[model samples]
Target: MYSLKLVTFVVLSSIPYFCYGAKREDFDLQKMFEDMGEEGNKMRDECFTENEMSLADLHDYDKAEDIPEKELCFYKCFFQKSYVVDKDGKVIIESIKAIEEVKDLEESDRETFTNCLKEIKPVLECKDMVEFEKCFDQILM
Candidate 1:
């Protein structure tokens, strides 16, 4: 359950990272996830399983280099499943903002998060996870 919270935090923070000239548009985040049902949960479990990661491993990433390639891709999978990232792997900021968690953020935190998202250009590949993680830290940590 704790791992799920970690995954949720990671998703909301990094969801805005994958934009690459992709047009932003608002989406019904609640409806989107509702439609997904257990698909997201399945992906989360699969990512952890495939990466051989445990909840303990989640806290071990103190640095970008400390994150494994598999873990980075796991983030991508989460965002993709949420549709915050398109099939082409481009992030839609509006879609991210539509998320209930992101929406509920305090005003100042939301501004910081928005800025971080705009500044970071993530490719949804293993190599760029560090950049996204760095931006996420600045916003929420």
Candidate 2:
């Protein structure tokens, strides 16, 4: 099952890094967050509407099993903003190592998480991107 806490944690934890290493004038913190928030909300609403679920459902539980099909779409939508979202909406073995560059995770955990997902079967399919994210969340988070 996927944990939204971990999903938000890992993704939120990277905000600083995404903002840093750029020219000061080139980065507008307020505008950037505003944009992300808008995009996030738009995706969230769209997913909820399409999946026939409500955002309130997100508060209903912690387990992935409790997650509704449409709500899962939010994960895929959020991931779309980053390179982390694969073009095929599936988890990419080689591309996942990119998380290694993310300072939030330790070296040991990274390998373990990657390998664990590698062992999982349904996770290998991108037929459902949200489920793919859930698979990674179960391990990586």
Candidate 3:
């Protein structure tokens, strides 16, 4: 009976893990942005500025007729590293180690300014200033 109870407890605990790993087919960026409201726009703007690319420029790049394969691959890799998708299709923040490389900033030179790192938690870690803004908006919303 004790062995059976132990097995049951283990199975019960694992159930949450399995359920959490289930793929979410309805992940909506629009809804998330809407949820963020003004804060989302601010974050997006900050991200664009930090990346040195305007929203129009990014849109144009995405809509480019002939984007280089290597560039596309690089973007994919970058997104994957930032987003932290798991084998089970669940997304989580993996690491924010890149934040440590920042140099020569005034008040914003700390580990993470604007609480972006704390906001993303363990699913979408932000490594840099640009990513921090993006993740901050996403988490805030």
Candidate 4:
């Protein structure tokens, strides 16, 4: 469970690199939120509060190190609530592809992301998340 936190760090930490210092213009956070819709927004707010996390926390994470427990669970909560992962812990490929960040990706990059999604374990666990983090790092970082 805790190890999943590190994986979440790796996934979100990649944002800084691609977003170029986590700038809104580059990352379009507003658009991302809008894309998330009402349910997703509520989930995001709840997860942020529950985890005591903010965008700054996402920026502060170091992908080279293990992710903190709160942060990891934050991602997991967001994933589950947003239907990125189902109740049974299966990746929802379409939902992931629909994310603003994923939509902004270039065709090849999107394909790579899709491939990574396909590689995820059937039942998500900390180890699976760790592998996902590694895969995300290879693609984005």
Candidate 5:
């Protein structure tokens, strides 16, 4: 009986191993791009609507010296809002790293970094796994 049980267990384990090694098609890049685009657009629309501001309404500063203390407040608000909506963990990690990066920048550089983050916010909000993988690839690249 013990020998029969061992054989049964070995056969069952082999079945899964065979299934795991089955050939699968390569990832579809076009579908990934489409999904990313769609997720990005939806996130952008929702963010703008919730904040009651158009994308064009984001603060503009002409000089590094021109950034007021209120700009940091805006960054904090944006980070808080965006971080909570991230269903996938990738964006949250990126946002945290970006925040840390911004902390070490000069006033002017901080402004530019923050603006770049704002631009990429929609792309980071993507919750689809395929799109998330694509975004991760792009970030790493």
Candidate 6:
């Protein structure tokens, strides 16, 4: 059985990504959650190894205020593999367009939006995934 802690992380971690991402086939997210058993753990372990990251540095969900670089990469890689996040760590523009409130943004704001997304690219462009997320948060604000 998956630990309660891991389960909580799955839910919490999935929300922001899903809320911001374009819709996919039905049960894709659900399958990702369900598959996080043996194969998932192994994949995560391999990702940590490949990324020169250590599982020891990973923080629990409650302490996830600022993820460490390597740990963040692990999550990023895993989510990308799961198709929950794009390879570039962006909120797909299609997803943004599908939202009801997004229709109301002024055209000028769209430039700001596009620029902000471009700025976020540099974050993902680097090797440090935590910084990528941080840069996204900063530029996206």
Residue clash pairs of candidate 5: none
Number of backbone collisions per candidate: 0, 0, 4, 2, 0, 0
Model 3 RMSD in Å is 18.8
Per residue, candidate 2 scores C-alpha lDDT tens digits across 82-110 of 43455554445554554434335576666
lDDT of 1 by residue, 17-120 (tens): 32211223223222222222355567766665767764334433335565567666766666565565667656667766766677788888877877776677
Question: How do all the candidates rank in terms of TM-score, highest first?
Answer: 1, 4, 2, 6, 5, 3
Q: Each candidate's lDDT (Cα)?
A: 0.56, 0.44, 0.31, 0.56, 0.33, 0.47
Q: What's the C-alpha lDDT at position 14 in model 2?
A: 33
Candidate 3: residue 88 lDDT (0-100): 31
What is the per-residue lDDT of model 5 for residues 14-131, given as tens digits with 9 covering 90 to 100?
2222212222221321122123234344544454466564444433333223323343223223333445214423244444334433345466655543444344444332222223
Worst 10 residues of 2 by lDDT: 17-26
Highest lDDT, which number? 4
TM-score of each: 0.61, 0.47, 0.23, 0.57, 0.26, 0.40
Q: Root-mean-square deviation of each candidate, in angstroms?
A: 10.7, 10.9, 18.8, 8.0, 20.5, 10.7
The TM-score obtained by model 3 is 0.23
Could you tell me how far off, in angstroms, the CA of residue 97 lies in candidate 1 after the best superposition?
A: 0.6
lDDT of 4 by residue, 19-81 (tens): 333233523532343334454556777878877876555433344235555655666677676
lDDT of 6 by residue, 4-117 (tens): 235334533453343233344325544554455665666666766777865444433322244445656666666455443476576455444333344455666655554554
The lDDT-based order of candidates, best leading, equals 4, 1, 6, 2, 5, 3
